[model samples]
Target: MTESTIITDNFLLSNKKAVLLYHEYAKHLPVIDFHNHLSPLQIAEDKKFDNLTDIWLKGDHYKWRAMRALGVDERFITGQASDEEKFKAWAEVVPATLRNPLFHWTHMELKNPFGINSYLNKDSADRIYLQANERLAQDEFSARSLLKNFKVEMLSTTDDPCDDLTHHQQLIKEGYEIKVKPSFRPDKVFMIGEPVTFKAYLKVLGQKAGVEITTIASLLEALKNRVDFFALQQCSISDHGLSTLPTHFTLSLAQEQEFKTFLKSDQAVFSDPDAFAGFILTELCKMYHERNWVQQFHVGAIRNNNPRMLHKLGPDTGFDSIGDYKHAENLTAFLSHLNLTDQLAQTVVYNLNPADNEVIATMLGNFADGRIKGKMQFGSGWWFLDQKDGIEKQLNALSNMGVVSTFIGMLTDSRSFLSYSRHEYFRRIMCNLFGSEMEAGLLPDDEKWVGEMIQNICYYNAKNYFGLNRG
Candidate 1:
């Protein structure tokens, strides 16, 4: 249970001010992870892992990608290899991930939940695995217990429009203390090009909403129905994943008639997918505004890059990469269109490409309109950019171009329960960034002012922005 030399109390806190800021302001704050991909079923059932690998490695594309880079066999990475073998393989690759965020995250997770601060490697893998597995057998290591242990006050899970939400309902019935709300994610609703998949999704969505979606009008009605359903379930957020915002948002009468025909004829194809998406998404945003909801866009991911592996493993299994889509023009148009209509909801835009950091940061200013605090947010470092360097770049970009003080901070955006350590990792890096500035006289020597900002970024801003503290 003793701390390892590597993961001491002062792990990432380098300067004296950094150490002071971390321990005093950031360390004990309750985490409000506004977005993630955790399983509602697991939390509702209070699922416990049989071993460390079951909890740590399953559905973790980040580790899977790294294992592939190190030439580990697919059998060990994601194939039919036993859990023990997978753990051994991951342990062997740990030392090689020295500079990668995986190294820090791996240790931080182990240190906190398992209280095993030892550095993981091939030699220590077996012993550490046994220790972690033993702990997993205890009640405190169950899925719900883990969230409580991580000091997670609230977290939102990405869910589709047609999701039954039985698990979410179960949590509510049981009165789980942690707020686990579902964020409406209807990305599939925009897939007009893939007629077969889109058609099937529409049927399900229509059935759930109690409306038959035959035309564009009915489609909007069905979506609104689902939005109302989500609101009743205590959902106040919506998320969309796109390469970039669509510019061709207006649908002419001819195009609208064409959409109805496309719905009926299987062979019919929509010529302009962007136009279709834009039209639908614009209407959806209006509905969100009506509900007083927060909308989040996670843009710029080029997914399923490796078609061979994608076919073998299906989507979201370590084949996605940061996309270089141009954002400024279309993003501006999309937001402005909403703003002109007075339908712009509180939006947080997360870009996968590091090059788009300043683009998103500055875009936030164009739409802030003085109505809501941080109405347009440049979201936290996302996907590939959630690491230390990316976090620093995002913070610097916001500090330079936007109001960093009003910024709602980090989100796990992760599937694994153990990924809560990422918030800790982000807090330490943020404290160090500000702490170092204080020591160098770049910022004022007043701890109270800076510490309050740190606390806001760590917890308060997100709490207020999302209205998590409200009934």
Candidate 2:
């Protein structure tokens, strides 16, 4: 029998225009991954995986979730099972993930790196495993080479405020080919939902900045210092993962007593403190604007739902899901608070919930004041919504409500090195959309015009938007 088609040359491109757009324009553009969870340390260290499972199975919550759903034992996923066992377990789940994005991503990763074209299943598990592991033993499959294989031009890694960014500094000193920059992700500091942990985080930030975090003012100041430090390290982007935007707008709690009262309030629960989050984000955005930096908000993920598994495996082990939280009012208020002062930085807003796609797309246009082309971006499909359908919806929503042409595009937002295939996956879907428009007479059949637009969305837009060409 013929093998399943997952990573074909014309995969997902239905029409002539799409196939041409993808092959001519989108295919060869280098990726600019502006936001991701990739470890700078691994890149700096030039870490080499011992086997395919070491790179593919480990820390990949996407695969872990699928394996668990297939009733594969936990030992084979995020447990004490050997690497070979985990690979076999994932192979078992791959066949069951037919309609899921993982099936395609799995195949794309296999084909791109290992050149393994066979379907991953119970029948082919052992052979594919040995073949991939044997290939991993080679020099080109190292972490850095894997990035180079994807032609990743530059990538911004999500980093905590308390992080020293020593690894980023090391990469700069090593003079690696791809630019790996750190993006300030101070979500935990404002995550006053866990006051005790938040307070501990505050102490760490204070120590990092050589300041005392007694109130919100000091906290913001300490954060500003860290932002300055990150800037010194050539960092130019800030990222936040939030459930919803905050409603309150107390600029800086002027009175000490009021600040103390608010700080000590029982309002800090499992839910994010909207008032505090909005206020802090408003202030942080100003700092970003001051530095001519970009800010990204990954909103509406309800994380760590399974208490039992959360206690055992910890967060980001695939226990998160899309949240239906109302984010418009607070997100609008937060951006407005910054825009009125003319301190709103170039922003990218990403929502996990597909329901909020248009909400965010429309909301972004409210803040773009013609200064920059795509000053405020309705970001690409994110988190649970990065698949084909999700990509189509986000592209359509942005195209309908805002300027999709100038939109900064795909990022892995993942921990694994092999995940850069996601950019290719997104580009194929994007070209198909634009190509179909041309074929249907919706867009003129000017391949040159539409082709450049495809390149802009795939690479150039992000390159210009992030000032990647500036230095």
In TM-score terms, candidate 2 sits at 0.96
Q: Which pairs of residues have clashing backbones in candidate 2?
A: 246-274
C-alpha RMSD of candidate 1:
1.5
Q: On a 0 to 100 scale, what is the lDDT of residue 63 in model 1?
A: 97
Q: Model 1 over residues 1-471: C-alpha lDDT tens digits?
A: 223637789888889999988999999999998899999999999999899989999999999999999999999988999999999999999999989989899999999899997889898899999999999999999999999999999999999999989999988888989999999999999988889999999999999999999999999999999999989888999999998999978899998898888888876579889999999999999999999999999999999999999889999999999888999999999999999989999999998999999988998799998878988999999999999999999999999999999999999999999999999999999999999999999999988899999999999999999997685
- The candidate maximizing lDDT is 1
**Candidate of highest TM-score:** 1
- Point out where model 1 deviates above 4 Å: 1-5
Candidate 1 lDDT trough over 10 residues, lowest sum:
1-10
RMSD of each: 1.5, 2.2
Tell me each candidate's TM-score.
0.98, 0.96
